[model samples]
Target: MDVIYANSELICSTNASINKCSRYKGQKTLKKEVTVHKWIKVSLIVLSVCLVFAFGGVCTLAILLSHATPLAFFNSDFSVPVSDQDQNATDYKAQFDALRHQHEETLRKLNRLNYSTGCALCAVHWIHSGGKCYYFSKFKMNWTQSRDHCVCLGGHLVIINSKAEQDFVNSNVKVTHWIGLNDLETEGHWVWVNKQPVNDSVEFWIKRENGIREPDNWTKGHPDGEDCAGLGHPGGETDFWSDAFCSLEKRFVCEAPAAV
Candidate 1:
């Protein structure tokens, strides 16, 4: 009886030990499954974050490309060499300067043309004839004063050198006017204002019908000696030069070179 009881106790102890071991193994398997599931979830989350960042980068690049100008894309300095760029800038500047010079030259030529024409170059109320400009003054002044006035006007008193010029002055004068011929320095030796001696051979002095010549210095019996010359209708003879007193106030003619 004792032996049988011993064998049964031993069998019961072995069964309890086996059942505890089986339960421990089942718990370990459940822990392993939970760890694997956690690893899979973490990997899936990382992949999703990577996919989102890649898509956002692509969209930002596309937006930038769309907003950029066509020229901006082509204007990059890397496409052209530095020396070529400098050469192009120099060429462009040279072309601009050339065009500016051409424009200035054209303006100068137009101004010269306007100045060279006869009547167009003369001042208002001035007459142009024989490459000269003449101004007939309406006011009266003494011979010296008239010469000074002509000087102030950038000219001198009329110096008639030919019959045609004498005729022109005689025909244009409204009344007796002072001319540039005078013997102010030495009496009876006539000279032009420019200091040239007058040639009496081709002189335009009026000759009377009785063969008497003018410039007789005859001014109503008062002979301080007429030193200044004038052109007018003296003795009913027009287009003739006559010596007159320097102090006599008379209308004058001024002459200047015509602008060319």
Candidate 2:
């Protein structure tokens, strides 16, 4: 009976040993599974971080590209209060508006002062030296004849002094009345009948031909060595003149100071 008991004890001890080995093997397997789960979790977290960083980088790049190129469709309407931008836009707009208003006012004043517009005027018998008339006659004679006639009238042909005055006279002349201008006295050195040097800079001349006296100085080819300059209505055209002889018959444009 003791021997039977010893065999049973041996069998039980063997079974317990086998159970312990199985438990050890199961524990090892569980440890491997936990390690694998931890590895997967770490990899997932790293991937998520990378994706967030990549998304943020792409968004930043997109914004920078939009700023550097014309791809941005949004126009800052400036209706919003400026926080980071230059704040002078409003001030610049105000200054521009003020300048525009001032320009308009100046133009109004000029229009009131000069009711006339032309490059030259005829029959300007009045220069208001405070207010008085300086009388003289301008014959639409050839350059030479015009000079002689103006001299006879006790004054030389008018010399265009200013753009405004020139335009005024030219507009009112109604004919290309002879003025105190001719290259005949000297080539290219045009002088008024009063012998005042012609200021080509102030008034420009149109040239049809080349190689004369400073074609830049000639107003549509004046004083082409013609002895006469006649201003009269020719063939129902606005009166303009060609070089002619003084013997031709035509009306005269007289000028004098405005009668007080």
Candidate 3:
């Protein structure tokens, strides 16, 4: 009878061990799959950007055609939201990356704003100041998604080039918002969405309390450190630019040339 009891206990322990091993293997497989998926997305972003320079902005996104049937099934509705599709949607990703790369090249060569064409009226839900039209979105999105959304809406993220512009944007700020500034290409070298490097002469960063520094790389919020910029709310020394995680979802400000 004692031998029988010992044999039963051994069988139970073996089954438990098998279950644990199976679960561990399953978790590892899931993690591996997620890593591969992330790499694929990153590859797509690079491919889209390179394709823009190669094709000179003439070619359209190929993935858009893949969902032709589904796209055509729904009628266009512009009022719902600026970014109705998922952030991974290729239409805006392709356009945004292509537009960004093109702007980077053109802004460097021409040293000009590509979309700031003529003096124009601000559209509904947008503010007019300094001869530029700025839009404050109610929805929130990550830095990359917000950047792409601005391009989708015929503009880019707000580029506060001067104190006047900064003050104007600051006064109207209802909450923290994403700006066009980022150090994605190179750490510590901040640049605007227009590809213009930050002019060190002017400064408006979050107040240095206790001398901690504004961009203290808080939390490694971004994969390459705190690579994105966020505009703080209206407060003494608080209404300024601060580095934020690129993955953090925040409201964004969009800037464009006034329509004639």
Candidate 4:
């Protein structure tokens, strides 16, 4: 009986040991599975965040590209709507055209008035469209010097505001008379005595080959670096102008005008 009991006790102990080992192994396996699941979840979360950021970046880039316009003329490859720029250019051109037309009408009215009502012994030899009369000086003058003379005479050097005025000046002056147009105030932006912009289309007559260096426009020789302008006869002939010195004596034109 005692031996049987010992055998029984030993078998029971062995069974208990096996069950504990199995339970421990089961717990360890569950723990490993949980760790693996946690790692997988963390990896998925990280990847999702990266993907969202990448997609957002792509969307932003696409949006920017859609708005950009190609500017090939200026060597800018990007494309963007140039509607505003075009509108601005159009507005400027319209303003310039209107100003030119107004100048023309003003001169026509002056011519009609002059024909009806003549002047004194010193008849109006020249008529500026923008309300002025010009009497070419019998002497020559440099640009600055001539301008000063005009100011003293209570006016400015004659500014050819239109083709008609230019033609008129060309007809009256036998020699080039110092006029008010010059790039002296701002180089490359030629302005008349009245500070009006010289139209690029109306080519001012220059001395033969005088504008060789700057082939874009007409420029008479003689008063180099003096910022002077002169008038010429109708046949593209330049007759008068002076350098920077106002002291030099030359023929001058006086101006007066009928009311517009």
Best by TM-score: 3
By lDDT rank, best first, the candidates go 1, 3, 4, 2
Cα displacement (Å) at residue 41, model 3: 58
Model 4 lDDT tens row, 96-213: 7887677557656766766677632223344544456576776666556777776555456776656777677667766546666666666567676677776767655443455443
**Model 2 poorest ten-residue lDDT run:** 127-136
Q: Model 1, 1-260: lDDT tens per residue?
A: 99999999999999888999989999999999999999999999999999999999999999997796757656865555556768999999999788757655754565578666532455577787766679999999999999999876767898887777777777787577888988889877889888888876657766778887767776576567788888854345556777888888988899876654
Instruction: Give TM per candidate.
Output: 0.52, 0.34, 0.53, 0.40
State residue 135's C-alpha deviation in candidate 2, in Å: 6.2
Q: Which candidate model has the greater TM-score, 2 or 3?
A: 3
Clashes of 4: 29
Per-residue accuracy of model 3 over 1-260 as CA lDDT, tens digit each? 99999999999999999999999999999999999999999999999999878786444444554445545535554423335565448677798688878755643443234345443466588787876789998999999999999987778999988998988888877689999999889888889998998888766777665876666666643445788988973242337888878888988999976543
Error of 4 at 224 (Å): 7.2
The C-alpha RMSD in Å for every predicted model, in order, reads: 25.7, 20.7, 28.3, 14.5
Candidate 2: tens digits of C-alpha lDDT, residues 145-208: 6556654544456665666555555555554455555556555565555567757576534333
Instruction: Count the clashes in each prediction.
Output: 0, 22, 1, 29
